[model samples]
Target: MDETDQAIVRLLQADGRLGHREIAEIVGLSRSAAAGRINRLIESGQVIVRGVVHPAVLDRNSLAHVGLVVRGPAEPVAALIAAREDCPFVSLTSGPHAIVAELRTSSAHELDEALSGLRGLDGVQGVETLSYIEVLRDVVGPVGETDHRIDDVDAALLHVLQSDGRASYVDLAAHVRLTPAGVRRRVLRLLDAGVVRIGALVRQPGRDGQAAMGIGLRVSGDPRDLLEQLGALPQASFLARTLGRYDLILTLRAYDPAEMLHGLEQVRGLDGVTETVSWTHLRVVKETYAFEGLAP
Candidate 1:
């Protein structure tokens, strides 16, 4: 991805639902120009813009991650299953030797049905279930754009900030070819407009920093309310509900097994939580969001 692509990614990362005019104003491109760029990005499969609703919030508690350890091959199975709308995340690797997928649904019974569908698949062998007690969502690749405003200078500033949020006002001013005050004002506008999420990229320490342990949860009560309450917690890094043994699936970081177990316990102890399963970070193998390429 080049400079322009990175800028687009940043804007979407902050607000995937941003409109064409808003993106154009910030990217310093014409409305048509921005539209064309977004179209190309979407067509190329480099970015996916969608409304990821918490299934439980919608009363669909069937969510699951099916870790498939096949015998003969994996590529075909991965390709075949990736087409499922319920299959939001897919990964392929040979370490644990399998093609694993993170699937979603609305309830546990639906999850059983989904599993039945998977088990009926030709190459599928085994399945491990992880229950998600809580799911935390963040701006991974843009969501919606209720708040956004960008001008030529603002777009230039955002381009710089995505590369380094800590860049000084003076440095940003120089890079964007704007006066110090102009750059500062634009920066303030971006913040006020919510074009970029400003926060520390803090690591939880140890291997946890390197691996995203996926956990699934089965819960009771109003599943969506439970997910919303859990999503509001500080420890939740990523959260979603699916169909299977668990109603929710989440990613977390920890130092060791003990930490992971502790985190799992905390999740299981929630008011409406029924149970949970903690999976070791065997391997991420596949994640489109982790591509980190503004351009493919």
Candidate 2:
């Protein structure tokens, strides 16, 4: 992707519903040219525009990261875990643990059940879980309150958006038997309430001259101050306060290994940080925010 493509991707990442003309104005291209480029990007599988449902929408509020120590080949185990709906983000890492997966569940009981299910999988020797206390930053926009109300019509609209975020208001109105104006109002309400986010999900983004790592920090002093400091870094993608072997967990992306090293060193030098552990993501097996069966 060239600079223009990258800029378009960034714009869509922020708002997937951006019109071709709007993007064209920002990227200094003709409207037709911008539309062509966006179409090409989607057709070539470089970018995907979809609505990411907030966990709060479905009452699936509990979030945790589970690292697994596989007895043998990690791919087979990783594949098995990747197939599970609850484990949305899964990867094979170069570190103490071979596989790491994120589990999204509704309650403590559900989380326990999911962990027990993972323990029963073959080649799973041990499991380490990190429960998120507060998510300072999330890739899918802010994690909003869980009390957002939605009816059957709203769920249907969300389901359609999940498949095609840029679906025209007229098209959406057809799905729910509402007028285009009413449909637009409903969609805007959902977006403004933070119940759903329409954005671009790039596949294998690290292939674009980038390196990513997961860092686990053990902090001694008040973590609030440290969280604010770390969360402000440009490289930080996902940041959270957690309970487990680490107090704070985050993911960083950089242009090269030296830059990654520099970012790591910067984190280490922070005042409250006591110890730090990090793992390089060898491969991301499954990273999805789409919640299936939206209608409830």
Candidate 3:
């Protein structure tokens, strides 16, 4: 995690399929050296490159944020929720809610069942849910419709990419029985249509004194202007309008406590903001964008 490593990560975050030579050109290193560093980073479990299927493709349109109040240890409850396929983001925080998780499902009924399952778990005292009305910003990439229909070959490619986003076109061709050129075309089509995004998922926050916080805001007037303002901030990672105790929710990542406070204060100064509540993430039990199954 030196400056060069950080630069390489930024490149991968933009496009995980970047070749070592390309990365080396930008980072000012030999191709083999760049490749060595990237391999070490992945081997160390610091960064994972994968294809993140859009919710539209999987029919996981129903998305919600659930905060749990546990009677006993929160780690066990968090671990239990993390094991569920639908829950992608889960963390233990320092706030009234001991654990917070995000659920993505195909329908509202499934969402209810998932919540009920959570409530039935031992040590679960209460559950607070925030259903997303509209996602303004996503951590993966721009949200788009499922313009390209997924056939068997496409499905195979997606599944492989989920495991290894930087899989060579020749390797992908062998998997799907298509020519390398054809495989490349199909992969590009998926990326262009936004059906899938190829990027790096940081398993842990950067070791450079970085910290993250979740902020819930209650806004008054037209939120459109406010959203535009908040969305432009560099620290704002995720943003959404939701149906719950809070009108808007977002996650901010900063280098230190003072920087986090500054970001929060900036949000408070926004015109339409009425009140705000926040919690520092004590531990991120799980944060993954990859899904298990892709329907054909």
Best by lDDT: 2
lDDT of 3 by residue, 1-296 (tens): 77788788778877999999999999999999999999998989888888888887878899999999999889998999999999988999987699989999999999999999999999999999999988887765446456567887888898888878889999999988889999999999989888888887667664445577888889997666688888888778789988999999988876557767888899999888999989878888888766778532
Clashing pairs in 3: none
1 against 3, candidate with superior lDDT:
3
Worst 10 residues of 3 by lDDT: 139-148
**200, model 3: CA deviation in Å?**
1.3
Off by over 4 Å in 3: 206-209, 255-259
Q: What's the true lDDT of residue 23 in model 2?
A: 100
lDDT per residue for candidate 2 within 1-296, as digits (tens), equals 77788789878977999999999999999999999999998889777788878887877789998999999899999999999988888989988899988999999899999999999999999999999888887765546465679899999999998878889999999999999999999999999888898887666647755567999999987787897789777677789899999999988876567878888888999998999999988888887766786862
lDDT of 2 at 196: 90
Name the lDDT value of residue 227 in candidate 3.
83
Q: List candidate 1 stretches off by more than 4 Å.
A: 1-136, 139-145, 200-211, 232-234, 241-246, 283-296
